[model samples]
Each structure stands twice: as C-alpha cells, then as structure tokens.
Target chain A: MILTVTPNPALDLTYRVPRLLPGETHRAAAPAVRAGGKGLNVARVLAQTGSAAFILTTAGGAPGLRLADDLEASQLPSELVPVAAPTRSSVAVFDESSGETTVINETGGPLTPAEWTALHDAVDRLVVPATCVVGSGSLPPDAPDDVYARLAAAADAHGLPSVIDAVGAPLVRAAEAGASVVKPNRRELAETTGLDDPVAGARVLLDAGAGLVLVSLGAEGMLAVPPEGEPVHARLGTPLTGNATGAGDAAVAAVASLLAAGVSDPSALVRRATAWSAAAVLAPLAGELAPGFRDVESRIETG
Target chain B: MILTVTPNPALDLTYRVPRLLPGETHRAAAPAVRAGGKGLNVARVLAQTGSAAFILTTAGGAPGLRLADDLEASQLPSELVPVAAPTRSSVAVFDESSGETTVINETGGPLTPAEWTALHDAVDRLVVPATCVVGSGSLPPDAPDDVYARLAAAADAHGLPSVIDAVGAPLVRAAEAGASVVKPNRRELAETTGLDDPVAGARVLLDAGAGLVLVSLGAEGMLAVPPEGEPVHARLGTPLTGNATGAGDAAVAAVASLLAAGVSDPSALVRRATAWSAAAVLAPLAGELAPGFRDVESRIETG
Candidate 1:
C-alpha cells in the first residue's frame, strides 16, 4: 500500500455565500468540513482510484480528535501522531456572484522536538513494507529543513521510491536526496528556482538527482521530465473554470499509484496524471476525480 | 436546575488573522472551536457562574459530533437529540489590525418533523424539574413559528419561569404566551415592535403578558421594565471596548440564574444582568466573564 505523510493536517471548512463584501456580516449557507492536509488528500484520492493507501498525520486537541473521528468514520486508514498544539483549520469562502473562493489558512503551530521525532519515527515504521512513500505539504516551524530529504534517504535505504511535493528548500533537499519524483506548480517552481520556463526548472530538480520532475502549468496543463529522456507536456481539449483546490494532491496520488503499479511509461503517466488533476478540479471537493475523468483522460494528447 | 433549549446549535470556529481583505488569501493564527448556539452559550455562561444548567440541542453528522465532543471535553452538561441534517458551523474572523470581528453565521438546515417533535417532547420532560426554561436563538425552518410560545406555556404549566431571548415573530409570540421574561437588544426590540424608544418597546412586551422586559441599549447600558413596578435603567461607569459576541447570552444567563434563585427585585436583576453583559464583552470568548466584571458590577448603578 502507498504511504502518505502529512505533518500538518487540517479540518478544511468551506462556507458559501451569495456575495462576499469586504466588511459586512454574511449569513452563509451551511458550512462543510473535510479531512485535509496535502498528504492526507493524496491518500484519499489514491484510495478513491482503487489504490490502497495509508495516511500518517499529526493531530492534537479537540480539532485533532475531530479529524481522527472523521477519518475513522470514513474508514480511511490513518496513523495519528499526537502533538501538544491543536490541529489547524482552513476556510474557503465561496462567493456565488463571482464564483470565486477566498481562502483563509491558519498557520500551523510548531511541533515540539519530541513531536517532530515521533513523526519521523512513525514515518520510518510506515515506510517499511510499503510499496511507496510520498511526503506533501509544508513542514511545521522548527522542523528540520530536510525532513523530506531524510524520508527520501530512508526510503532509498529500503530500495523504495519516495515522491516529494513541496516548495523551496524542502523540494531542493528532497531532490538532492534522490527523490523518485518532485512535483511543483508553475509559481512554486519559479519562486524556488527563479526560472520562467518549465523545462529549465524541471532540469534543475532532475540535475539535483530527482529521477523525474512534474510541473503543473495551470490551464496550460502539466509538463513531465525524466532525467534521461525527452520532456513531455499535455493539456485538456479546452480549459474549464472549476475549483482547483486539491488538484496537485490528486496529481501526486496519480503518480504514486501509477509508480506502485509498475507503470514506467513516462508518456502514459503524464497523460493520466494531467487528466486526473483536471477531473479533481471538476469535482466540488478535494481528493476525488469526477466520473468525467474517463473522457478527459482519453482526450489528453501528450507531445 | 436551569434547562436551555437551543434549536440551532453550532460548531463555533474562530479564526484570528492579521487583517482580512475581501477575496484575498489570509494566513490566520491557530483557530479555536467551541460549542455554540444562543441557549448553549447561556448554559455555558451560567455554568461558569457556579449555576447548574443543562443544554438540550439537536445534533447530527460530523459537525454535530464535533460540537458534542467539544462540549463533553469541556465538561458542559448537555443532551443532544439526533437529527438527520448535519449541524451548522459559524465563523468569526478576528482582524488583529483593527481589532474587529467579522462574523459569518450559517443558516442552519431545517429539522425533520419527527426531530422537532422529539425536541419539544424532550423539553417538556426537562422543564418539569427545571427552575427556569430558556428558549434561545432562531427556530429552524419547517418548525412551528410559535415554538417559543409553546415552550413558554409548557414552562408556565410546570410553574417554572420561562425566559425567552429571540427576535421578530418568536419574540412577539413568547411575550403573548406569558413568558416570565423576554430579553431583546435595541435593534431587535425596535425591529420587532417598530418603536424607536427602548422603554416603549419594552412596554409592548410587558403589556403582552411578559412579567419583565429587558432591553440592551448597547453602549447606553440596559433598560428593564417590570409589569408590577416602575422601569429601571443601569449603565457601566464607562463603556469598554471588547468582544461583544456572547454578551447577550451572558445577560440571559445572569437573568436565568438570579430568577431561578428567586431574586425578584427588578433593579437588582437589571443591575446584575447589565454588569454580566458588559463583563462578557471584556472577556476574550463568549459565555464567560472576565475579572473586570467585579469592578464593572460595582460601578453599575440602577436608577
């Protein structure tokens, strides 16, 4: 089974209103809460695609308990490491007039040294007997800058592949530690490497020892680069306006599942990942591709 | 014991941000979650004051489960009736720059007919031993508009005092049903009675069979009208700026506790209630007064 690590999980809350003014009272429609955190989202999407995945996450206090309870009720397999700080919550206010979402993400509190160690230990144990391990999301404050690097090395020791999706130092470190795959969105890639071209940015990660690099190009679609092969790019037939909240997580899930299932063709992996990510945007919530993924997948032509 | 009925209880999520700009992303500090609803807030405040209060509320699905779990963790005594729809969540975004709180209250879903009956039958049973029965917050759609009226009558039949805190038609009906007390703020009172004067608006409720009418005059303090005595008004030495979220609930709790203990003097009730409400404003959260309440109470004058 694929193993996913979420150092900072959250209870994602979404509120819907007819219009959102700068300073005013909003009588919103009923709010919705979901299990969140990039890695957790990856695991959820993978499971929906008929892949078995387990989530390793940190949780604490009442909100943490609620997250655990939600996972338990959903029957999603997860290992919750306890922390002193409460888990954070993120809100997405959907404005119906403009059909836009305004997000407010709580900065996750730092974990104690002991808490960080526990997370590392948990990941160490989970990576064993696992087909693959993927680390997604930002590190809690005071956490080691190379947490994904450490995880990549640990998985490397076990002769397993680890997919790393992060920004800045963590992404660079994971690549340096020989990560199997590194995925970054266009802005993240540019901000991290100061490169406007996707191929040039992907080349940096590949040169840093990442076996492959996938860079999301928003409506322009996604680009895939294998260190020793020609780069490939794919997009949908037409751009669609949809909620792209967890599209990246959906892409990582697709990569992990395909890699675990022994899909080594770079072109096929790129096409499927692009279609799945697009399908995720079409769905209302994060972590699952809509049924239209089938049609989207067939129409995605890679060059 | 005091019994509090909350027809629309919620999971109260408070997010603290540096500043909030519409349609922009914000990275908030950690959020706080609590069991919230008008009656539940009243019950929580009363319990903090060393008074016994039991909350009767509807709960269903994940959000409801979280609210109940939070209440249990907080050691708040509550009985939750099962319902089909998930309970709602309310968000309060505190902008640190201006120290302003922007609130988004969700419009709770309608309870099934059976659920409404269950809540009423449960209240009828609890009101027997309850010294005071409080009907707080709005009625869910599909519920009888005269629910507070029926509840007041039920409490009256049990020889118990029924305190109603509501607006619009429910307030009018509760007063007509011979409620022991009805608490309304300046706007709510004016809106309901279409009267500009607080005394005149309170007189309307008193004339409709309410034993006492307490009208919160915002910064002007509070005004009380008793059917058997001259009206009384009390104000703090000077109005203090603080969170006024649960001030009304705090006032209701003070009224309930004093009324339950057989404190019948209108001036004493009005002074204590106004001080408690101001104390709530000084506190960080709803349902509990801060230490400044002692000084505020001593400064309160009823004339």
Candidate 2:
C-alpha cells in the first residue's frame, strides 16, 4: 500500500462568489470544505484511481477533527497524529464572472517536540510494508527543515520508492536524500536550480541525484528526465484551463502509481502523469482526475 | 444581569496577506479567529465596558466549538444552546497594498427544532431576572424570521427591556413586538420604512410601536427618537472610518448598558452609543471598544 505524508495539512474551504469586490461583503453562493494538503491530494487521486493508499498527517484542535471528519465523509482512509494547536485552514474564493481564484493559506500550526516525535513514530509504523511513500507540502513552523530529507532517507533504507512534491529548501533536501522522483513546477524548479530554462532546471534536479524528474509547465503540459534513459516530453494538445492547485500533486500520484504497478519505462510514466495532471485541471474539484481521463491519455502527443 | 443573544454567530477569520492576486496563491502573514455576530459583538463590548453580560447563543460542531473556545479564552461569560450543525465561518482577506478587505461569509447552519427549543428555554430562564436582553443579528437558515420578535415579546412579558439590533423584516417584527429600542443603520431603516430620510424612518418605526429608534448613519453618527421626548441628535465630529463590520453592534451594547443602568434619556444614550461605536471602528479587533472610549463618550455632542 502507498503511504502519503502531509506535514502541514489544512481544512480547505472554497467559496463561490459571483464577483469579488475589495472591501465589500460577499455572500457565497455555495461553500465547500475538504481535507487538503499536497500528500492528501496525492492520496485522494491514488484512491480514485483504484489504488490502496493510507493518508498520514498531523491534526489538532477542532479544525483538525473537522478535517478528519471531512475525509471520512469523502470515504478516504486516513490516520491522524494528534497535536495541541489546531490545523491551519486555507480559503479559496472563486469568482464565476472572471473565473478567478484567490487563495489565502494560513501558516500551519507549530509542531512541538512531542508532536514531531509522534509523527515520526506514525511514519515509521506506516513505512514497514509500504511499497511507495510520498512526502508533500510545507513543513509546519518549528519543524526541522530536513524533516522531509530524513523521511526520504528512511524510505530509501526500507527499499520503498519515495516521491517528493515540495518547494524551495525542502525540495533541495529531498533531492539530496535520493528521492526516487521529484515533481516541481516551472517556477519552483527555477528557484531550486536557479535556471531560467525549465528543461535545464530539470536536468539539474536529475543531476542532483533524483532518480527521475518531472517538471510541470502549466498549459504546456510536462517534461520528464530519467536517470538512464533519454528524455521524453508530453505537451497538452488542448489548453485545459481550470484551477491548477493540485495538478502537481496529481502528477506525483500518477507517477507513483505507474512505478508501483511495475511500469519501468520513463516515457510511459511521463505520458500517464501528464494526462492525469491535465485531467486534474479539467475537473471541478481539486485532486480529482476526469472520469474519461484514461481514454484521453493515449491522445497526448510526445514532443 | 444582562443577557445577549446571538442567533446567527460566526467564526470570524482574518487572513493578512502582503498582496492578494486573483487566480493565484498568496501566503498569509497572519491568521486570527474570533467569535462573531451582532449579539456576540454587543456582549464583547459590554464586557470591555465593565458590564458582565451572559452571552446566550447556539454552539455545535466544529466552527461553533471554536467560537465558544474563543469566547472562553477571552473570559467572557457565556451559555451556549447546543445545536447539531456547526456555526458558519466568515473569511476576511486583508491586502496591504490596496488597503482592500475581501469578505466571504458562509451560509449559516440552520438550527434543528430541538435546538430552537433549547434556545427558547435559555431565553425563558434568562429573561426573569435579567434587567435587559439584546437580540441581535440575522436569523440562520430554517429559523423563523420572527425569532427576535418572540424574544422581544418574552422580555416585555417579564418587565425586562429588549434592545433589538437587526434589519429589514426582522427589525419590523421586533418593532411590532414593542421592542424597548431598535437600532437600524440608515440603509436598513430606509429599507424597512420605505423612507430615505433618517427622521422620517425613525418616525415610521416609532409609529410601528417601537419604544425608541436609533438610526446609525456611517460617518454621520446616530439619530435617536423616543416615543414622547424630543429627537436627540448626536453626530460624530470626526467620521470613524475602518472596516465598519461591528460598529453597529458596539452601539447596541452601549444602549443596552445604559438602559440596564436605568438611564432612560435618549439624548444621553445616543451620545454614549455613538462614542462607543466610533471607538469600536478605531480599534483593530472586532467587538472591542478602544481604551478610554468612555472618555470619548463625554466628548460626544448631543443637541
């Protein structure tokens, strides 16, 4: 079974407003709440794709309990490590008129030393029989910067394939820890590699010891670089425009699922991952690939 | 003892961002949560003003629990009537560059029949010994629109004064129930009376059997009209400009506090209420009148 870790999970709230006027009160047409974090998104996509995965995360206070309840309501399996402070909440206001989305992400709760130990214990317990482990999203305040790197190292020691989807220093540390795969968007990849050309940045991540590198280019699709194989590319034929919040996480899930299913070909994995990312963009809800996404997967062209 | 009822309270959340870009992710600088509703605001202001009022409201589910925790943390005395569904949460995004505030209010949870019964029982218990009761804010979904009217009637039956702070049909209903005082903003007074002029609107509400009428005009201060006394005019020399989210509620608390203290003069009440309202606007925190706001009350002009 796949184990997904989201250190800084949140209660994701979406408000649908006709138009957002600054310094004005808006009554939302409909409001929705979901359990959200990058690893949780990956776990959700994997579950939807008929894969067995367990979402592991830390949650606290009433908001954290509500987040767990929301996941339960969605029929998603999860195990929560308890903490003292409440989990953070992220707000997304969607304007129907402009199709614009404004996101306000709360900085997640600070993890105490005991809470960190509890999470480490939970992860250790889950890693024993896990075929793959995915570490995603930002670390909470007070958490060590190299926490993801340590988790990746533990996965490597256990012979479990590890996929890292994060940004900035966390991404760099995850790569150095020999993450089986690293998925970073163009902007994050630029920050990581300090390179303007995304293709060159992908090469840098590959050279940094990532067994495989997947760089997502919004609207342009994805680029893939494998350790021992020639690079293959898949670009979107149609502009799949929608909320791209969880597209990268979905791509990580796709790649992990393909690799765990024994698909070793780099080009085939890239083709599948890009199609899943595009499908996620087209879907109304975050982390969900479209119903007929598999049928459209073969239609994607390689560059 | 004073009783303050908030039928539709909210978990008020504020997210501070350096800049808010539509259709993009923005990291929050800080996030804060507080109990919100017109009646709760009144209770908070009353507490700050050295009046110990019992806050009576529905509390259930995650948001409601969080609001209750916040009130407790603030050391405000409260008696929560439990409900099945969670209270609503309102999001305010502050953009520093534009000095713009974007508010997204969630639709409030409707109280079940049992919850309504519990609220009614709490009101019955509080009305017998309470000097004054304040019924404030909008009715939650599935709640009777005349709920405030019923509460006002209960107060009247027990020889207790009820200050109604609501708008539109609810204000009309409370007035019809002979509320001791009704505070409606200029727009709400116009909507309720079909008259744009505050004097005319105040006359209409007095004719509708309201014992006293206080019309709040943002920046222009307040206009008070009593059943038998001359109109009391108390206007702010300097317009209190801020978010203006809970200014009216602060005004209601001032009126309630004065009425409970046996101050029946409309001129003095309006002066104190307007000063408190202005102070609330000046303060950054909702429901809190600034320090030395009582000193400002003495400076208010009453003609």
Candidate 3:
C-alpha cells in the first residue's frame, strides 16, 4: 500500500464560464468541487490504477468537512487529521471561449503545534505498515519547514522507499534525508536550487542525499538521474495540450506505485511516470487519470 | 419582530487580490465568508438598529453548514430550514490596486419540491407572530416562480404588513399579491415593467396592487409612490463611492423596521430608507449601516 501525505489540502471548486472576462459579473455554471492536493491527487491516480493507496491530510471547518465527504464519495481512500482552521478553497474558472483556465488559490492550514504533531504521529503509525510513503504539496505556515524531511528520515529509518514531491526548503530537506526519490518540476528545481542548469540542479539535490532525482520537464517529458546508472530522458511522441495542474501528482503516483510494486529500475519507473503524467492532462479533473494511460505508456521512450 | 426570508441564500466568499488578471493563477488573501442574501442582509441591518428580526432560509450541505455557523457567530437571529442540496457560494474578487470588485455568482438551490414546500411551511409558521414579513432575493431554479408572490399572499391574509425585494416575474407577482411595499432598483423596475421611466414603472407596480413602491436610483437615492399620495423622490446630499451591492436590502430593512415601529406614512418611510441605503454604501460590509446614517438622513430630501 502506498501512503500519501498532503499538509495543505484544498476543497477545489471549478466553474465553467463562457468567456471569463475579468472585472465583470459572471454567472458560473454548476461547479465541480472535489478534494484536491498533490498527495490526494497522487492517491486518487494510484487507486484508479488498481493500486492500494491511502491519503493522509489535514482538514478543518466546513470546507474540510466537505472535502472529507467528497473523499468518502470518491473511489479514493483516505484518513483526515482534523484541525480548527477551515480548509482552504481553490477556485478555477474555465473559459470556454478562449480555452483558458484561471486559478485562485487560498493557502490555509493554520495548524496549532499540537495539530502538526498529530499529523506527524499519524504518519509515523501509518508508515510501519506502508510499502512506501510520499509527502507532497506546500507546508502550511508555521509548520516546521523540515516536516517533509523528517517524514523522509522516518521512512528511511523504517527501510521504506519514500518519494518527496515538493519544492523549496521542504524539497531540500527531503533530499538531505536520502529519500528513495525527489521529483521537482523544472521551475521548482531551478527556483529552489537557484541554478540555471537543470542537470546541475538535480546533481545538487543528489549531493544532498537523494538516491534518485526525477525532474519533470513539462512538454519535454521527464529526466531521471539514478545513483548507480546513466541519466535517462523519457518523452511521449506527441505533447498533450490540456490542464497541466495535476500532471506532476500523477507522476508521483506512478513513481510511488512502481517502487511499491518492486520496480527498482529507474528507467522503467521514469517511462511509466511520464506516461501517467500525460494521462493526467487528458483527464478533465485534477486528480484523475485518463483511461488511455496504458496506450500512452506503451508509446513513451526512455534513453 | 420582523421576519425575513431568503429562499436562495448564499455562503459568500470574498477574496482580496492585488490585481485580478484573467486566465492567471492568483494567490488570494484570506477570504471573508458570510451568510448573505437579500433577506439576511435586511435582517442583519434590522438587528443593528435594535429591532428583533428572524431570518428564515433553507440551508444544506457543507456551505450551508458554514453559513449556519457564521449566522450563529453573528448578532443576527436565524433558523435554517434544512434541505439536501448544498448552498451556493458567490465569490467576489476585490482588486486592491484598481479598487474594482468582480463578482462570480454560482447559481444553485436545486431544491427538491419537498424542500420548497418545507420552506413555505416554515415561513407560514414564523409569520404568525411577526410584526411584519419580508421576502427577498431571486428564487432558485426548480422553485415555483410565484414563491415570493405566495409569501406575499400569505402575509396579506394574515394581515401582516410585508415588503418584497425582488425583480422580474417574482417582483411583478409580489406586487399583484398586494404586498405592503415592493422595492426594486431602477434597472429592475424598468426591466420588469417594460417602461423606460422608473417612475412610470413604479406606477405600474402600484396599479398592480402594491400599496407602495420604492425604486432605488443609485446616486440619485430613492423614489417612493404610495397608493393615495403623490410620488416623492428622496436623495442624499452626495453619492457614495463604495460597495453598493446591499444598498437596496438596507432600504428594505429600514422600511420593515419602521413599519414594525408603527410608522405607516410612506413619505416618512422612504426618507429613512434612503438614508439607510446611503449608510449601507458608506459601510464596508453588507448588513451593516455606517454610523453617519443620521447625518446622511438630515441632509436627505423628500420632495
């Protein structure tokens, strides 16, 4: 079973508007609301692929209750760590005319020190039985910046493979803990490492103790640098042009699920992860993978 | 006690952003969520004036739960008639640099027929002991178009003076039900009555059986026409340049609270209502009147 942790999850509300003109009164169609976060998205994709996945998230107030209710109603499995602050809502306005999507994110999770510890304890308990653990998304304000690093450290101590799908200090700390893999998108890797060269940035992360580094290159697909093997580049023949918000999450799911299934080859994992990321773009929702993922996976090449 | 009903109330989420650029990702500031609708706005304003006003509205799902919780936290009085559908959320993006407010209304209240009848019955029960009844806002889809008319008809039969703040078919029907007063903004009045002149449109409503009609003219203030008295126009000395979303609701609140206090004179009612409407714009939030209402009232004209 793969366990995913999202410290700052959101109740996502996506509304489809005809034109989406800014500074105007728009009448949005019925919104599609769901539980959304990087870890939650990863768990959802993992579950859809027939992999057992459990989501560990923090939720509070009414939006949190709604997120919990949605998780129950969905095919994904989850456990919530309750808190006092209301979970945040992310609004996405899809403009039909221009084929554009506008996103407004409300960052939340004002967790007390006790609440943060509760998450740590829950994760500690779940990691023992978990085949692999994944920590994703931004840490809420005031949360110790090294929380993800600590999770990676704990997973390492337990002899469990771990994946960290985050950026900034958390990403650096996770790498320092020597997690099985650390996946950062092109921009995040560059921003956190403050390096112009992507390969150099990945090397920097490897030096910090990561066993493997997967840098998502967007349209160019993915790059994999393993400790004992040659660097590999994987890409689909044709680039997908759809919502890219959850593509990285899908990649994280693929990496975690592949590792949990005992696929130790970094090349095989990157090929599968890149295909799944493309599938996420084809799907309409953020936490969903398209049905054609297997076909897409067959077309991806790693060299 | 003044009784107010909002058949399709909302959980309002307002976010402040430095500037809103369409089709872009925005990191919004902390949002302000509240229970808001025409009737609830009226009830809140009445509460501020030391009048006992009870809000009767249908609430369901998570947003409804949040709205109920917010109402409980506020000073206003309310009772939520439970339903199965979640209440809708209307998001307002306030641009700080430009001082522009963009509103996105998610039209909802897909209330089942059983839910509609439940609201009707609840309103019937509450109106019995009420000093005056007020029904406001647009009815949700699937609800009978004559819902407000029916409420007005019930108020008439119970000999309860009532105010209806609505537009279009609902507004016309409410007028036909002989509601004690019907307030429609100038645009709504002209659109419903198909008259270019707001005064002529108001006259048409009075002819349709509304004992009085108050037409809001934005900066020009308000216009009142009674069944037996000549039409009177009231205006504050200056126009307010703040949020005017709830100005009309404040007018309804002033009218209802005054009627409950046994002030039946239409001219007197319109003067105070205009002042309160101006005060509402001066204040930052809906359901609140600025303390300068008395000063604004002293400068208002009824001629």
Q: List the global CA lDDT of all models.
A: 0.87, 0.85, 0.88
Candidate 3 local lDDT, B18-110, one digit each (tens): 888887889875689899888999998898888899999989887888899999999577889898888888888888888778888878768
Per-prediction TM-score, chain B alone: 0.96, 0.95, 0.97
Best by TM-score: 2
Q: Using Cα atoms with residue i matched to residue i, what is each candidate's TM-score against the true structure?
A: 0.73, 0.92, 0.88
DockQ winner, 1 or 2: 2
Candidate 3 global lDDT: 0.88
Clashes by residue pair, model 3: none
* Model 3: per-residue Cα lDDT at residue B189: 89
Q: For residues A1-303, write the lDDT of model 3, one tens digit per residue.
A: 899999999989888888976677787756887999889999988989989999999999878888998999985777899999888889888899988888889878579989989999999999988999999997777778788998898888888999999889889999998889999999999999999777889999999999899999999999998876688999999867988889999999999998898786888889999999999999988778999998999999888
Q: Which candidate is the best by DockQ?
A: 2
Instruction: Order candidates by lDDT, high to low.
Output: 3, 1, 2
Give the poorly placed runs of model 2, Cα more than 4 Å off: A113-125, A158-160, A227-231, B227-233, B298-303
DockQ, candidate 2, comes to 0.62
Tens digit per residue, CA lDDT, model 1, B122-225: 99888888999999987776667788998899998988888899988889999999998899999999999999898889889988889899998887888889
Poorest 10 consecutive residues by lDDT, candidate 3 chain B: B137-146
lDDT of 2 by residue, B175-262 (tens): 9999999999999888888899988888887888898999898888888998876888897776556757788988999999988998
